[model samples]
Target: MSWQAIAKKDLQDSIRSRTLWATIGIFLALILLLSWLFTDGSGEGTFIAAAGFTFLIGVLFFIPMAGLLLSVKSIVRERNTGTINLLLSLPHTRGEMIVGKFVGRSVVMVVTVLAGFLPALLYIFVQVDEAGFTQLLTFLFALSVFGVMWVGIGIGLSALVNSETQATITGVVMFAVLILWPLIFEQAGIELPSFAQRFWLFVIFADLFFLPGRIADGDFTFPSVVEFDEVLLEELNDVAISVGPHLQMWFVVVLVAFWIILPIGIGYYRFSTTDL
Candidate 1:
């Protein structure tokens, strides 16, 4: 079969599946609820920052879950249904098959993000005067990169594993590792003897997860104690700046490129070698 046919079939299967829509729905609901609770009617600059940051966290969790769910069965399910053999017998190369699957599923993820997040963003813009268009745009760009990486990782894991359960578990474990690794390292409290050492450490950790360490760095400014009122709607300005250590932008870009390419290369290698 042609690559176009393969892509069409995969896209149809995804649309017929309700799990994809369900996951996106849940994410949208969470974002709306959080916005209602945290956002004040005021149009302060900090309000935009808070909403954008909260939305970023929500998308981080949502994108990985969606990627894992959509991709965990891309190949294993075909094998289970005895369709893999027929597909492998086609004139298309293994690389074509793998690439077609990735493209099809990645398209689904992109649509999901646009559908679920775009309207929510519009609502925020209309309802909250504090919403900054620039910040929102930046958050969306970051989220797109994050989503693509997770989808690539999921496709790679699915291609490598034989069983659907194994693929699902592997995807979940990898997601957890990527998401939590930075926090784990930070909590471990490695003694940084010098500024150079600290900078390199940030770069190393950030590269592993494909996230800029600057985003994760905690507030460097003093005035450690934050009042309780600041935590509630009564005071939104009490949030402290958690910024100090940061990875260079170039380092993040390189890491993102590695995340997308390396897994896909391995998937192609495995697909090429596997017996039809």
Candidate 2:
């Protein structure tokens, strides 16, 4: 069969898998639980905002992690279990195989996201006005983009690593680094020089999941994103001034797209060239 067929088979397999179903069930349960916990008894603006924020925080972080976990062993597991060899024996190129793996995992991720959140989204749309519905759409878009990026990341790691164990560790370590590096650097009092601040900011931007939390609080400025002193700002001023007013809207999206593509691009290069 072709790569599309392979992806379809994998998606069907995941649907039949008990673990996948259980994860989806638990995710749905969490949304229901958080919805009740955050919603006010009065069911007014307070309830809507609280419930929206609650689900946003829960889903934004959880989806990437779930996608990463689902994809962690996409290729490596097949390799470890000798299935990669079997797959290669079929009429498929290595590129087709890895691409199929990514597509399969991404379908699973998007399905998981929609299944978990669509119920709440529907409720929000029914209860809230047009502006709130627009905001919710924005939230969903961000979550989906972020989820796709992690799928690529997981597939990339799967292609690069030699074993399932290595892929697992690599995915977890990458997640931890993205989540904790900024806090760790700040807590350690390790101040980067002025010239390096913009580059550092760029590294931080690579973690798109970071933006949802900040966006939830209605803080969308650079200072809201990462802390910077006068010196660092002065150093990074050239970088910021270059982008100017255009930086606020679509610039963030380009960064997200970059993170999404870079890993898979690099990993596909490695996967295609290497013997499976």
- Highest-scoring model, lDDT: 2
Measured against the true structure, the TM-scores of the candidates, in listed sequence, are 0.74, 0.74
For model 1, how does the per-residue alpha-carbon lDDT over 1-276 read when each residue is reduced to its tens digit? 566777788899889888988977887887777665555545444535555555656655777788777776787778777787888787877777777787788888877777767766666676666656665665555666667777777877777777888887888898787776656666898544322232232233223332332344652221111211232533456554342333233345555566767777887678678764
Prediction 2 TM-score vs. true: 0.74
| Alpha-carbon shift of residue 134 in model 2 (angstroms) | 2.4
Tens-place lDDT digits, model 2, residues 1-276 = 578977997898788987777777877778766665555333556424754576665544677678788887888888888977878898988878878888888888888877877676666555434435545656566566667768888888888888888998899898777566656877999975433332232333332434555567775554322333432775777554232322332245556566667778788888788776
lDDT of 1 at 237: 66
* Candidate 2 residue-pair clash tally: 0
Clashing pairs in 2: none
* Residue-pair clash count for candidate 1: 5
RMSD of 2: 6.1
RMSD of each: 8.4, 6.1
